[model samples]
Target chain A: MSLEKQIAISPAGELAAKLNSAQLPVDACYQCKKCSSGCPLTFAMDLLPDQVIRLALLGQEEQVLGAVTPWVCSSCETCTTRCPNGIDIAGVMDWLKEEALRRGYSIPQVQISRFHQSFLETVRLGGGRLSEPLLLGLYSLRSGKTLEKLKSGELKDELLLGWELVRRGRLKPKLPKKLKGAGEIAAFFAKSER
Target chain B: MKVSYYPGCSLEETAIDYAESIAAVAPLLDLELAELEDWNCCGASAAHSINHTLALDLSARNLLIARQAGLDLVVPCALCFNRLKVAEKALPVPQENKGKTQPPVKVWDLLDYLTQPEFLKSLAGKVVRPLAGLKAVCYYGCLAARPPKVTDKEAYENPGNMEALLRALGAEPLDWSYKTDCCGAGLALARPDIIDTLVKRLYDRALAAGAECFVVSCQMCQANLDLPQKRIAKKAGRDYYLPVLYFTELIGLALAHPEVDKWLARHLVDPRPLLKKLGALSAFA
Candidate 1:
């Protein structure tokens, strides 16, 4: 259907209009919970995928965007594949994640907003690639690994694992090096503000 | 026989063992891998989860490089393949590379590339030391086998390429349900409890099906499964030790690469004992 038709059909709800504007097929979902049932990580989500889509159709913008489902989603796409309406449900979650960021709604650890922020920083550190230790280190700092917890040995297991890998000669110490053409990639990312 | 290879960043870090194995076995399989020059990250799950355009742009850069190479791009890491395939899917319609006339570079998951019918037929003839008694389950995770429209994988939910590849190498590939299940990979650091739950579920089902080891192509799945066994065992109150070896590592073993011991040694849960018990370990490996 055309954007005109989508707008005409969903004129009553702000959320529906937003979904249509974003090109998500919000009008097609009929409240079948196949997405919810098939979701592997719903136990930690505040709203199931189906419930969030339903809220979007009803123009419940606050609930739709504020729900932790988007951040909790791992982009597994089982929900998208299993959807009878071809709703691109995982894409919906991605959109919601970005939307939530724009709208300033986030939960620190449970929803992974901090982790993602750290990830972008890590990527920038590598110019356009990823440095594993940098990502872990940045995330650990941003997620607020308190000194008291560190002193209490809360991270003992993780530290022990790190030591083991290092001892096995798996980790080589090095500073992040720029890729040959990374200057162009850096300018592109900066212009996009990603 | 020659393909541009994208090892992804994890292959340099957490999954270095998987990379070492691929380097050892690709030659034996008559596959030549030229690393995609100056390839960077595909933005991974992090870029895609937020900033969809950046995800596409990041992956599009790698795709452009692979197209310049003028060869099919074979990615051993499932996550990198997914991100690149996503960008490739948008090449024609999206404005990023709409006017470029170069032929679209074909992106292939390593397992799918290795399991082509002719390749499998040849692979069967090349296995010198058959892994006769090894029982392994192929854990695909959700990277390469979902959203069929994007990944171009038919029967996405029921992928059999890994099974076909394993069987050709004379290993018994078991039928299992969690083959395409998500192990909560992207959110692993954010919410480890969720990962533990998902991993335990898969492990229980795999154990029930009599699987001795897991063969994974994704390094994220390997880390998610391999790193948590001791914790899960303590929580579930059971002995914890199940090897999560990469598909490439197992192929190295089957092809009689003695240095497989070096790769397998990197795994958290040792796989050599099981291989030794079954007499599946190749000489000196």
Candidate 2:
């Protein structure tokens, strides 16, 4: 059977509509492969950038969500800039990641997801700014992998670098002074939860 | 020219040197940077990926602050600039502010300010030390000049604004392919292996082009390239010693300010030797 014959048209059309509403024109992508060619992390991704778009256009949401490409994308926007169709491929990748989170799919790249949560928590704690030490500490604890490196002393180089940064006043030991409108910022996050 | 400045989160903490250098060089170029008071984070990569509405609201709050100030906003961090600029375009007008067809305020990247012919002309006469022929490559990274639609830069793919500023500072800007390449940005913390690979490619190309150092505008790029070059070099089994400095820091050095060293000392990879070699340091030093 032809690959086209294998796909269900109804679901594919529905997925395309959903993606269009999110401002990601996956249907506009012509499989030029320019996005994949320009993506720096393609070597590490399970599927190519172009493949992700093609699968989404075909409404293969489970496969697309399960793949590691969306989670690993750094949102560099190189693909979006280089796309001949101007499809905002990077934005589509972001949408895929968001959908994966919403649908409760397990992220293939656990570290990246952990870092994102830790980063947002750090922002919330700082009332907007990032506290470097706090972010690193929380990320280490939350990820659990960094703690393994720490226990095994494999992170010694990172420690030395941290000390050097401290000496030069780059990394402060204290938490950042929270912005005055913490309540308002917290409320915005709370509203978004709904 | 007076503009509302948004230093974002990194500038307040890890990238304080970037903020210091910008302040140090602002007066010489006749630019007055008034930081936006009570400004919150732009949500950066964290919020945008997780919750789109939250990202829009976070950046909208900051833009509203700038709108009320009635001054054009200047964002020094590329990531923050991208977030704010994207928000300005994506957010809908609230019911209270509907039908206000015009954009409330314009967002300016630091390069947008420095690249102006008038600003460059004014800055040229203020150069006490003209970088003394230092060969440097301009690294735009991703956010400041990419996804042409969001940034609306004409030369997003091959931007020459940084090169123009380099020439004004009397440094030789080497033309390279990785100017707008990604440096792994926030992923630097999550995936060092990926950053190692990416930074290695960048360093290899810069070295091949005979660049003594890199001039960057993004705080994330500066952190990734400067802090990890040594480890990346070791991993790649190449002897690389390139120093990455913020473009503003170079301006601070060329201006021959007494406090320039204080700003230089904050880099993980020391940039003084490169500065000294090029004779870019002031006689007073």
TM-scores for all candidates?
0.93, 0.94
Give the residue spans of candidate 1 off by over 4 A: A1-12, A106-111, B93-103
- Which docking category, incorrect, acceptable, medium or high, applies to candidate 1? medium
Index of the highest-DockQ prediction: 2
What residue pairs are clashing in model 2? Answer: none
Per-residue lDDT of candidate 2, residues A1-194 (tens digit): 25884555445577778998887778878888999998999988998999888888988888888889988898999898888888988888888877888899998988888888888888788877678899988988888786677787658888888888889888887876667778889998888888
User: Per-residue lDDT of B188-242 in model 1, one digit per residue for the tens?
Assistant: 7778788889999989999988999999988899988988788888889998567
How would you class the docking of model 2? medium
lDDT of 1 at A108: 32
Q: Kindly list the per-residue Cα lDDT of model 2 for residues B19-112, writing each as its tens digit.
A: 8999988988888999998888778887888778788889888988888787889998998999988987886543444555444578888887
Interface RMSD for candidates 1 onward, in order: 1.4, 1.2
